[model samples]
Target: MMASRATARATGSFAAYTVSELTSLIRASLESAFGTIWVEGEISNFRLAPSGHTYLTLKDEVSGIRAVVFRGVGKRLGFCLENGLRVVCRGRLTVYEPRGDYQIIIDALEPKGIGARQLALEQLKARLADEGLFDTARKRALPSFPQQIGVVTSIAGAVVWDIIKVVHRRFPLADILIFPVTVQGQLAGRDIARMIRELNTQRTSDVLIVARGGGSAEDLRAFNEEQVARAIYQSRVPVISAVGHEIDYTVADLVADYRASTPSAAAEAATPALTELVNRLQSNHTRLAHSFSRLLQQWWAKVEALNVAGLDPQAVLQRYLQRVDELETRIGVCVMRNIDRVKEHVLGLCQGLGYCGPTKHTVRLVERVSHLTLRQDKQIVSFLETKSRAVESAGARLHALSPLAVLERGYAIARHWPSLKLLRAATDARVHDRVQLQLFNGCLLCKVQEVQQ
Candidate 1:
C-alpha cells in the first residue's frame, strides 16, 4: 500500500486509479476516437461463445487486435468467421473493463476480395456435398403425373402466380397447394426450413416445388442456407428447385432432386400436358380395337376353310353299308361250296352199292337216294333262311348305332363357330357369338342372338 502511494505521489496524484476505473477511462477514449472505423486484417483464433458472440483475433504481420461479433450483428453477417480468412470489418474499438483489454465490436464485416454471401454459400455447399446431399444417385424422380403439387414460396411474389398459371394451363387436372413463407431476410431461411419439414410430415403432396423469383444473392439468401438445403435433402417428396435465373445457382438448386430455370418451367416439368395425354389414350384404344378385329377375322377365315364333309354322317354310313355287302357275298360263296361237296359224296356212296343192272334192288336204292335228296333240300332252305335273318339283324343294329340315326330323330349337335368345339350346355356359347348346328343332312351356321340359363 505504501509503494502504491509512493507511485501516486511520483506521478503527482493524490490517489491511484483502480483497475476498473482505468479500464473504464480507456474504453471511453478508444470508443470515441475510433467510432465505426473499417480495418482490413486476416482472422485468427476464431471462436464462438455460448452466448452467440464470436471472439476472434484480427492481425497483420506485426500487430494484432481482439475483435468480438455480438449476436445481433453476427446474425446479419452473411458468412462464417473463420481462421485465416482476410476480412474488412466496420466496428468501434471497445475496452473490456473486466479483462483490462480492448477489442473491436464489429457491426458489419465482409471478405477482403469477395462478397460474404457468396463465400458462405460456397462453404455450405462444400459441407453438404461431403455428406452426399448433392449426389445424383440420391436424387429422386419426379412423378410423371402428380395429382397434388405442394409449392413453398412467397404468396405475395409473382413467382407463385407464374407457377400456378403454367401448371393450370398445361395440366388442369393437377391441384396446387400453396405454402406461404418468407423468401428473403435473416429469418427467411428458418421459415423455409420449417415449412419444408412440416410438408414432409404431412406428405399430402406427390411432389414439391420450392421456388423464388430472380434476384441478387442477398435476396435469394434463404435458399442457400444450410438448414434449407438439409430440409430439402430430407424431404420424402421429390423437390424441384426453381430459384433465380438459369445463370444463378444456389445451394438449394444443387441439393434438389431436379432444377428448373424458372418457376413456370418447374410447373411444366411437374405435370404432363392434358392434350397429349388424351391423344395417347385415344391412340392406344384404337390400336387395341384394330388388333381385336384382325384376330376375329383370322379366326373366321380358319373356320371357313375347315372341311365340313369330314364330319358328314352319310360318309360314315356308306362305309358300314359296304362292310355289310362284303359279309353277305362271302356267306353266299361258302354255302355254294359246301353244297357241291355234299352232292359229290352222295354220288360216290350210290356207285359203291353195285346197282348196275335194271333190278328191284337198284330201283329201291334210287328211291332211297331221292328221299335223302328231298330232306337235304329242306334242311338247306332252313339254314339259308337263318343266315339271311342274322345278316338283317346285324344291319339293323349297325344302323341304330350310327350318329345319323340320332340326327334323323331331330337331335342337332351344336358346336362353337370358329373353334369347332362341341357345346354341351347353353353357357358354352356366349351371346352375339356364331355357332354351327350339325343336322342330319348338312351343317347350318347361325348367330346366337341370346343365351338362356
Candidate 2:
C-alpha cells in the first residue's frame, strides 16, 4: 500500500487520483494504447479456475506477461491451453485496482504452428485417457452375427453407401438402420452425439458403427470433439469407429469398442461372410450324412451275421399269428366248460331242496336252462347283426372312395385296344382301332371310327 502511494507521488498524480481512479485511468490508457494486440509466447503455469476462466503466464526468453482469459471468452477458444505450448494470443491489457497490477486479458488463443492442432489433440487424449475412457478393459468385442446394425454417418456420403454394400456382400441377412447425422462443421459433433444418445434410448441395434470418409483434420474435427468421444464411450451397443483412412485417427476411435480402418472394413468386421457360412453349413451336412451312412452299414452287418434257425421275418410273423389263434381257441373252450359247470351246480341245488318236489325242481331247472339258452341265442344273433352291419357300412365307404363310383354317375372308362392303357382324352383313341369300354354294368369291346380333340 505504501509502494502504491509512493509510486503515485513519484508520477506527480498523488493528489489528483484516488486508488480506484488511478487504476481505472491506467486500465483506460492501456486499452486505448493497444486495443487488441497479438503476442507470441510460450505458455507457462497454465491453469483453469473453478469460475471457468483461465490463468496463465505467457513468457518469451527474457520477459513474461501475466495473462487472464475470462470465462466467456475462454469458453469460445476451440483448443485447450497447456504449459510449454507456444501460442499467439489476441487481447487487450487491463489493470486490477486492488492488486495494482496490469495483465493481458486474452480474448483468443491459437497455436504457433501447424502443430497447434496436434498439441490440442494430445492434451485431450491425456485428459480422457487419464479418466480410463480409452482403457482396453472398457472395449467390447463385436457380435459374431449382428441381427440389427445401426450406423451413424451422413446418408448422402459415399461412406454410408460403401458400408451398405460391404455389409450386404458379407451377410445379406443382417438388418441395417442408418441414423444420418452431420459428420463435419461446427455443429457436427453435437448432432452426432445426440444421435448416439437417441439410439441408445431406442435400443434397436445389435451393434453400432460411427463412420466418415477420410478427410483433412479440420474437416474431421467432429470425431475429435469431446462430446462425440463421450457419446461413443457411453454407447450401450458396441461401437465401431471407422472415421477415416488407416492413416487417420480420432478420439472417437480411442473410445470406441472397436476401431476400423474404413467404413467398409467396419461392416466386414460386424458380420460373417455369407459364402463362408454356406460352406460351413455344407461341411456339417456332409459330416452328418457320412455318420448316418456308417451307422446304417454297421447295423446291416450285424443283421447279416445273425442266424435264427431258418426263420425269416415272414415266418416269425406267421408263428406269432398261430400263437394268437391258439390262445383265442383255448379261451373259448375254457368259457364253455365254465358255463356247463355253473348249470350243473344250479341243478344240484334245486334237487337237494326237496326229493318229493324233484319233478317240480327238475321242471323249474329245465325252464331256467331253456330261458338262459334263449338269451344266449339272442345275444349271438345281435352280435352277428352288428358285425354284418359294420361290414356293409365299410364296404359302402370303400365303394364311395373308388374311381368306379364315377361310373355310376353315367361315366364310362375307355382303354386302347391291346395296350390296356386307359384313354383320358378323345385324341387317345385312334380312328379304326378297337377299344375296351368299362361301365357300371359291364365291359364293351368296340371299334373307333374317328378320334377328336
Candidate 3:
C-alpha cells in the first residue's frame, strides 16, 4: 500500500479543463452565488460604447464592482445613466473568461432616489425664478422677420440637423449660423456661456436658440448652470431655450427670451411658414378682385339707369318758355310805371323853376351891380384894410395853437421813436428807440445812443 501510494502521488495531477469549460463553470458558480441580486450604489466611470453597450462601475462605501448592460437592456431604461447618480441595478453575475474578471450583467436600473444632478438643477431653477429672471414680463418677443438665426448647441449632436431641416423647410430664405458648443459633460456650461457671449459680440443674428436633444435631468444639467442662465438673461438678441424633452425644464429655459419644447419646435418658432403665407396672400388677392368686380358692376348699372339725352331737350324748352313769359310781363309793368314817374318829375321840375325864378333874378342883378361898383371904385382902401386885419388875427391864433408852431417858437420837442408821440421829458426815453429831434427849422431822425439815469 505504501508503494502504491507513492506511485499514485507521482502520476497524479489536477484535472485540466478547456477555456470554454472553465468559463462556463465559473459563470454557473457566480450565477448561483448572486442570482438576480439587487445592488444600490452611486454610479461611477460610466461609459457608452459605439455598439450601444453601456459599461460602468457601481460603488458603495465598502466595495465597488464593474457592470455592463448591452444595447437591449440599456434601451429599456427610462432615465440617463450618469456619474454620481444613486441607482439600484438588478443583474445576474458572470465571469469574463478572456479577462478572468467577474462582472454583473445588468438587466435593469432605476433611480435609488432623486440624483444629485437633478437636485442641483431644481435648486438652480428655483433660485433663478425667485430673482425674477424667469418672469414672463421680462421675456422678450421673438422677431417675426428674423434676418438671421443663431444656434447654440453641441457641434456633434443631431439637434443641429433637426433644427436645420425644420428651418429650411419653413423659411428657406432665413440665414442660419451655428455657434458650436459642448452640451454635456464637465465645462459644458462654460462652453455654452462662451458661445452666447461670442454670438452677442458678433451681433449678426436676430434670434438665438440654445438647443439640444431630449435627455434625462442629469444629462441636461449643463443647461441649469448659473453661467448659462445669466448668459441667456443678458443676451441682446432674443434667446430660445430648447434644451430637452417637453416635460424637462431648466434655469436656461426660464431665463431665455422664449422656450420651445424641442429643437424642431424652436426652428418653427423662429421662421415663418412660407406655404401658409402664400396661401393667405392668394386668398386675399381673390377677395380683392371679387370686390373690385362687384363695384364695377354696380357703377355700370347706375350709368345704364340714367337717360341723359332723353330728358335734356324737354327740360331746356320748358325753362326757356317760362323765362320769356316772365320777361314780357316785367317789361310792360316797368314801361307803365316809368311813364307815370316821368310826368310827375317834369311837373315838379316846372314848379320848382317857377318858384326859384324870382330869387334867381334878384341874385343875378345884385351880383352884376356889385361887380360894376367894385370895378368903378377901385380905390376903396378902408374896407379892404379892415378885411385884411381880420384875416391876420385868425392866422395868428391858429399858429399859436399848432404843434408845429410850438416847435417853431425856439422850444425843442422830443418824440418817442416808435409811437411818434411827443416826449414831455427825458424820463420818457426807452433803451430801444429811434428818437426824433424837432428843431426850430426841421425834424431829425436819430437812433438812441444812450440814456441818462
Per-residue lDDT of candidate 3, residues 318-427 (tens digit): 99999999999999999999999999999999999998768888999999999989876775676688889999999999988987887777877788776889887667
What is the descending lDDT order?
A: 1, 2, 3
lDDT (C-alpha) at residue 295 in model 3: 100
For residue 181, model 2's alpha carbon misses the true position, in angstroms, by: 1.2
Q: If both were scored by lDDT, which would come out higher, candidate 1 or candidate 3?
A: 1
lDDT of each: 0.91, 0.90, 0.86
Per-residue lDDT of model 2, residues 240-328, tens digit only: 99999999999999999999999999999999999999999999999999999999999877666554345475666799999999999
As for lDDT, the candidate ahead, 1 or 2, is 1
TM-score winner, 1 or 2 = 2
TM-score of each: 0.53, 0.57, 0.43
Candidate 2 is scored at a TM of: 0.57
Q: Is candidate 2 or candidate 3 better by lDDT?
A: 2
Off by over 4 Å in 2: 1-37, 45-51, 60-62, 93-97, 113-116, 288-453
List, in order, the clash count of every candidate structure.
Answer: 0, 0, 0
Candidate numbers sorted by TM-score from highest down: 2, 1, 3
Displacement of residue 253 (Cα, Å) in model 1 is 1.9
